[model samples]
Each structure stands twice: as structure tokens, then as C-alpha cells.
Target: MTKESDDNGNTPITGDEKTSVPADLLNIEKGDVVDISSDDALLMALGYKPELKREFSYLTVFGQSFGAMGIAPALAESLIFSLGSAGSVGLVWSYFLGCVALIPVALSLGELGSSMPTAGGLYYWVARLTPTRARALMCWLAGYMNVLGYISIFASTIYGATLILVAAIMIGSDGTWQTTKYINYGLYSATTILCFGMTCVPSGTLSKLNNTYIWFQLAMALAVIIALPAATPKEYINSASFVFKEFQNTGFWPNNGWAFMLSLLTPVWVVSGFESSATIAEEASNAARAVPFAMVSSLLIALVVGMGVVISIAFTMGSDVIAIVTSPLGQPMAQICLNSLGEKGAIAMLVFLWFTSICNCSMLLVAASRETFALARDGGLPFSSFFRVLTTNKTPARAVLFCALVTLAEGLLMLVNTIAINSIFNLAIMGLYFAYTMPLVSRLIFNEFKPGVWYLGPKLSYIFAVYSVVWMTFIFTLLLFPSYPNPDETQMNYAVAVLGFVLVFCLVYYYFPKYGGKTFFHGPVRTIDEVIATNLQLEEQLVRKMTEDRAASAT
Candidate 1:
């Protein structure tokens, strides 16, 4: 290979076959520079040069909102209440089953994350590992499902926070807690806005904020485990075992076992957001390892801590648990805290609960935006280009803003009626389960036999995958039914609202092709190498442009 300096004092390297510089040093000739090598072109394409960092602490990996005590206790109480009598046992069973099912899913995700760690997480994995024909649709659906999950999370957090606040006032004062329509709506709106505003902070700053939340959760967990138990009357502890063999209204023994099984879905919803850690893979240091560990660890902690607290509270309260859960006051956990700990202890618990809600909201915000960005990156949604743009800070600013707006809109819907709020909640849960089922089904039907970098050893993976699908499908069906016996028109209307949304989604999907529109899914798997190549090509282009400008200026 040989290269010579041009008249402008720039050297161009060439193969052994040829090339020379002009003799005149003052004169320069400019021409287009063409690189024949694909590798070289690819290196020129990728814009940013990200240096992988090792800044993540182990605590940071596992210490997120999913494990928070405030959220978990509220969630447990909600499930217990929704399940009623016979439903309580079923709810507990479902929770355990869900946790067990997560083991294989986590193992699979860990392997995938380890191999190709990206911020998009599962959708990114789908794009890289699935056939191209299916990539767009899979990505789009994943994005939708991810957003749904986050929205539900946001709503739940606000609901939990509001309950905590209400609990504080009621427990502190001698008067009954007032529950006016305007007051409830105002609380939801305020919390939603607060959470949305908090998300607008820079990513690095947000990370630090989340770390603070992790500590808050720890403290709250300790307070619940220690303070609440110590303050309760010994007599109150003995009252927990008085079982109601029949419902006063329904006269049904154990209050319908099937209904109880259905009620378990509420708890599943509460403990469900652990996957948010994986969704922020792009932002995390060493995400491949960190995301998976964070996800699985969060779940384990939620299980251990959540069940422990619930059981402790249950054993202490005895028969009062049912009365507390069924009360019109409507916030069982807060009621329990107040009943057991009095005013000061209740306030402490409320503060912790509030903090946990904020933490969970933060995680949801991040997860939702990432899903929107990931879908846009794959050209699977409208205004894809805008959504795909990353700010100088390397965060998806537009997507974040868009998600915030949607959250605000949903929050506003709460003012319409309780039915509307319930409807939205049910729809969100349905969307989440629908999303979860798709990937599991896709894996089972299409990629079951395909070996890749991450395999759960063929037989077991397939078996578990099958089990997951069945479990999800069963739960999905049951979730459509209302919990209360002989539900009022409002409850029926809520069910209709949820179903209506699904029908709309299906109809839209059906009509997309009628106008000669392209379907999101196309064929072929995209490897990690492909994404790297695309990024590198952009980088090389920038470098080449810089080099050419220098040469021209010298001339």
C-alpha cells in the first residue's frame, strides 16, 4: 500500500497499485472521497461514541420502586379487599404462582439482556432475534403493552398515595374521613401532575432521585415491620382468627371460590412493575448484567417483604381484617396502619407511602418513555422519526413529554366518575396482560426450537413458556368479570368500557391494511452486529467529513 501528500498537504492512503500527490504545494484539487469498504462506511455512520461505564452500585441495581414497602402493603391490602373472603386464598395462590412463573421468564430475560443489553429491553430483543417480517408488529405491540403497564403503574401509585394521605387525616382526627367526589378527583389530579413533573428532570439527576427512594423504601419497610406491630393492642392481635363462614349479603359460603380466584389479579397488578429496571437498559451502566439482576431481585424482595408484612398484619388483626377490608372508607392498608399505630405512627407510615408512590411513578415514567422511543426507533408507529430523536443528554425527551401528556389526560378522566376510573384501570390491566401474553406466545409458537445465545435448555424453556401462556390466558379471561356480587350499573358500564377499548384496538388493526398501509411486522432477525454497524457507519461519515473540510481549508 502507498499514499502521497496532496498539494493541500493532506495524505491519502492507497493500495500498492497506485496514487501520487500534485507537485505544486500551493495548489489544491478537491474531489469526492469514496470508501469502498462496508466496514469503513459503517464506522462512519454511527454518531455517538459511548464509552461503557462501571458506575452502577449493586444497591442501585436492586434498589428501585418495585421493592418499596409503601406500595407493596397498599397493593396487598387492595388484593385482599378485592378478593373478599373466598377470594383471599386464591389471591395469595395466584401471587405465589406468578412469582414462581417469573423465575423462568427472568432466567430467559437475563440471558437475553446479558447477550444484547439495550435500553429497549424485550422489544429490542424481539427486533434482534425475531424474523424481520415480525419485528415491526412485535416491537409495536411490545411498545403498546409497555406503555399500558406504565400507565397502570402511574395510576396505582397515585391511588396509593391518596389513600395514605386520607389515612393520615382520619387516623389523626376523631372524625370520620370525608369522601367527597370533588376531593377524590382533586387528590388524583394533584398526584398525577406531581409525578409527571418529576419525570422531566434530567436522567442522571433522576437516577440519584431513585436511589433516595430506595433508601426511603427500606426505612418504610422497617417501620412497618417494627413500629406497627409494637403499637397494636394485644387484644387486637387475637381477633384475626374469627372467620366469616358466609357473606352477610350473599349468604354464599366462603363468598364464592371462583370469584376469590378472580380477585387474585389485583395483587398481580401491584407486584407487576419490576420489569421497569430492564426497560431503562440503555441508561444503566453494564445493563446486560444490571437490568436482569435488578428485575429479578426486585421481584424477590417484593415477594419476601410483601408476603411477610401481609401475613404479619393478617395474624395480628384476626377477624378485623375482613371488616377493615370491606369498609366504605375504602383504604384498608391505611386503616390498618391507623388502627394499629395511632396518629404519629400512621403519619410516619403515610410519609413512607407517599415516598414509595413517587418512586414507583419515576420508574413508570422512564419505562413508558423508553417503550415509546423503542417503537419509534423501529418505525412501528406514527411520527416515528420525531419519537426516535435523542436529546443531547441521550434521553428520549419527546417520548417522555408525550407520555406525560397521556398520563395527564388519563388523570383527568378520573373526574368524570368512579366508573370511568375503574374502566381505565381495567383496560390498563387488560392491555398489560395482552402484551405479556404475545411475546410468550410468540416464543412458544415460532421460536421454541430455535437455538440462540440464550436458551433455557430447550425442553424446560418450552414447558415453562407453555405454562406461562396458559396462566396468562386464564387470568386474562377472569379479569373481565366484575368483583362485587350483583354489581351495579356503574360496574357493568366499566366492564363495557374496557371491552370497548379492546374492540377499538382490534378494529383499527384490521382497517390498517385496507388503505394499502404497511403492516408493522416484516421478516428476518436483526443481529446486534447490524445495529452496531449502523451506528458505526454514522460515526465514520462524520470523521470523513471532518477530514475533508480540513484538507479543503488548507488549500
Candidate 2:
């Protein structure tokens, strides 16, 4: 267990010499007694001490991202956006192309995640990948964008859950009961609180629940895919031509081409939270390997399964896209389900979808809170110390509460105007992709890019990184456009304005005054010294134990 000191009176560890220490008189000798895991060592090297419990194995980590995507329910939540834009053909083809185009983005994320897996996600990557002179400013920009996106995701998903709940209630009531925005806001608030509570459980417990829920997601998706075709009357089912070739545009966009492109938002929204796997890297075992593998694999699975769900719906969702959108039930998917499955069956399906929607909110909340905690840990946010505090069970309770409060406040926008709330929700998708763009751009411009265990190597990595940046920029531009060419208040898209406000806030906050990020923040702070100190203490304790053992044996 002991290593012989070199002539310089220092003993080196097996992995990194930086972890070596002096081997003098009063010191401990045993290295085997303190077996540091690779995960812990790597985390230390990344300037952290593994504060979060590494409870999520590869499967559970994969489940985290997969469950966050909430493929079946998320598709249902955004189906109207696609179905209304280009009918069944747009619904199917747009999803397929959008998913195909995003593969490079996902691959680029996997590369960065593998190289530098941390809960800080994109911002940490930005800090490390950029030059020292620009590190703090770029880090601030990336961190705020990432955390804001996370909060927006939690709010939007909870809102989607609210919609599902209201739809379920109306269907259960046989469409006699009506709902308003006030009712919707109340349900959304309750669901947000409920998800925050769910996310406050011990990390181990939540990981287990996520593991179980991933299968539930698959089962529910398969059930709908199968049951939709089985339950739909032959008269209601559309033919292959109608499913694949029909183009219906209700928006005021210039042409059917633009309408089809607009449909891309649905898949983009559905796949919004797949990066959640990276946001939990600190809590995942073998994170560098697990995070990348989980992220790309989950998206790949979503691509196929999501296609199945959409195509199934396109065939069985009936011919009237406008009717589905304008249905009295207040949800497009609910109306489609009611048409295909009837009242009782639709209620059952909606209830299950509602439950999964809640789980999706919780899953997204976990990522959001972890992201907030990471940024706060780096002294990036106001009251950083407070939000960085973890609960007794090693969960980010304060960050969870902070995110929940933000979600509740953002939900108030629904009361002001529906379009305003929609802008905030759309901001989630735009802001997240904006965050995603920085690290890829950094890797491309900086020469310090390093590959980890799951890398795509030199040429392929550059290829993916290049494509990802180009594609994300194009998509972000597309996202800023309003659904219609000419629009009134309700039809106007304000997401661009929202994004501009967020950017201004970040710029102002970073350089405001003595409390600015420039004053205290210096990228991610290193805790490696603490780790080394703890190891030295443990080694000294072992030395004392050995001395006592020898004395006792001699006596």
C-alpha cells in the first residue's frame, strides 16, 4: 500500500503527479487505503470535489435525458404548431428533417460533454474553451443564457402539463366544463410546486424514479402508436397520400414552403431538454463517458420513436387540422384523441399523458436546478452562496426553490397576454440553442480543444462542430421570425424582443458596479486544493492507525 519516496522526498500517485505529496516523518505511507475513483479524480482535476452524489449510472443518466425529452407527451403538447402550419405532411416531414439536421448538434454536444463533463454544462465549456482575456465575459453570457433557458424550460413544461390537465378535466366532464387562463395559471402554479417537491427528494431516490419512468415513457409511446391505429375507425384514418403529401397552411406565412419550415419548431420544442444529461454530470457515475453516450443515444432513440408517434397521429388524427386546433377541449392532442378514442378512452389516455407531463416537468427541474447551482457555485448569479447550498441529502434544494420561484413569476406573463407567455416559452428553445452555440464556436476557434473518452476524433469532431454552429445559427434566425408574415398582437412573435432584453440584462449585470461579475467571478473556481488537503488528512490518520497497530502488536 505504501510507495517509496524518490530522492526529492516526494511520492507520486499512479495517475497524476500533481496529486503527489511529501513522504516525510510524521506522514502516512499508504495510498491503497485511500482509493480515489477515476470519476472523483477527474472531477477534482476539473476543479471540483464531487459534492453531488454519483448515484446515476449510465442507464439512469440515459433515462434522465430521455425522460426529460418526454417524447410522447411533448409531441402531443406541440402537435398543433406543426399540424396547423402544414397539415399532416408538414407534421411528418418537418419532424423527420428537423431531427436529421440536429444530429450534428447533438454530436457536437456529446463531444464537449465527453471532454469536460460538468454540471455547469455549456457555460463551463465556454470558460475553458475561450481565451483568458475573454473568459469572464463569455462565461457570463453563456451562463445566463443557459440558466435562463433552463428556467424557461421548467416554466414551459409545467404550462404544457397544465394544458394537459385542463384537457383531461374537460374530456372527463364530456366537454361541459370550460377553463380559462386564470384556471390554467392556477394549475400551472400547483404543478410547478409539485414538481419542485418531487425534485427535492434525495438524489438516489430521484434517480431510481427516473430509471423506472423511462420505461413508462416508452410504454406509453408504444401504447399510443398502437392504440391510435387500432381505435381509429376506418373512415377516420387517412391514406398514405394524405399523411405524406397533404399541405395545409393556416398561418399567414408567404408560402407552403415557409409553413413546412415553421413546423420545424415542434420537433425543436419537443427535443428541447435533451442536453439535461450534461447538466447532471456531477451526479452521474463515469460522467465523461456516460454523459456523452447518454445524450446522443437518447436523441437518436427520440428521433425514431418520435417519428413513429407523429406518423401514427398524422394517419389517425382525422382530416381537419383547423378543427383539431379550434376544438372546444382547449388542446389539439386532446381533441384528436377524443376523435379517435372516444370520451372514456381519451380521458384515460389524457390522464396518463398528464402524469408523464408532470414527470417531464420534474425531470427538467432537476436539470434547471443543477444548472443554477453550478452557475451560482461559480459566483455567476446574485446571492450565489445561497443558491449554491445543497440539502442534507446532497440535493440542490435552494436552487430548486429558486427555479420554482422564477417559473411562477414567469407564468404571470400569461395573465398579461397569451402572446407574451408564448414568447417566454419559445425563448426556452431559442435561448438553449443560443447557449449550445457558444461552446461549439469556442471549440472551433480555440486551439485548446481536447477529446475525452467518447470523442469523435480530429476530422469528424471538426466536421460536426462546424456543421453544428452553422445549423444552430440558421435555426435561431428561423426561430426569431413570426409564424405569420403579417401579424396583429396575438399573432406577433415577441421572442426576439425577449431575447434582446435577456442579452441586455446579462451585459449590464456583468459590468454594472462593484457587485458585477468582473468584481468577483473568475470562471469556475478550483476546489482541488481542498481535495488534496482532505486526502493528506486521511493519509495522516492512516499513519497514526498503523503506528498504534504496531505498538499494540509489540505489547
lDDT of each: 0.56, 0.82
Off by over 4 Å in 1: 1-58, 64-94, 128-130, 239-255, 423-425, 448-455, 485-488, 493-496, 499-503, 506-510, 513-555
Best by TM-score: 2
Candidate 2 versus the native: TM-score? 0.91
| Count of steric clashes across candidates, in order | 35, 0
TM-score of each: 0.76, 0.91
Error of 2 at 239 (Å): 0.6
lDDT of 1: 0.56
Summing lDDT over every window of 10 consecutive residues in candidate 1, give the lowest-scoring window: 17-26
Q: Which residue pairs in candidate 2 have backbone atoms (N, alpha carbon, C) closer than 3 angstroms, thus clashing?
A: none
1-555, model 2: which lDDT tens digit per residue?
Answer: 232456975343333222233332112354523334456555666777567878888998999899999999998888877887888988899888888888878888998898888899999999889999999888999998898888987788788878888998998877689988898899989998899889999989998999988988898899789999999988789999999986788556768788888888888888877778999998888788899888888889999999999999999988878888778776899988888899989989998998988888889999999999999998888999999998877888999999999899889978867667767667888889899999888878887787777778789989989998888888888888887677787777777877898899888888889877788888888755554555665344333343333343346
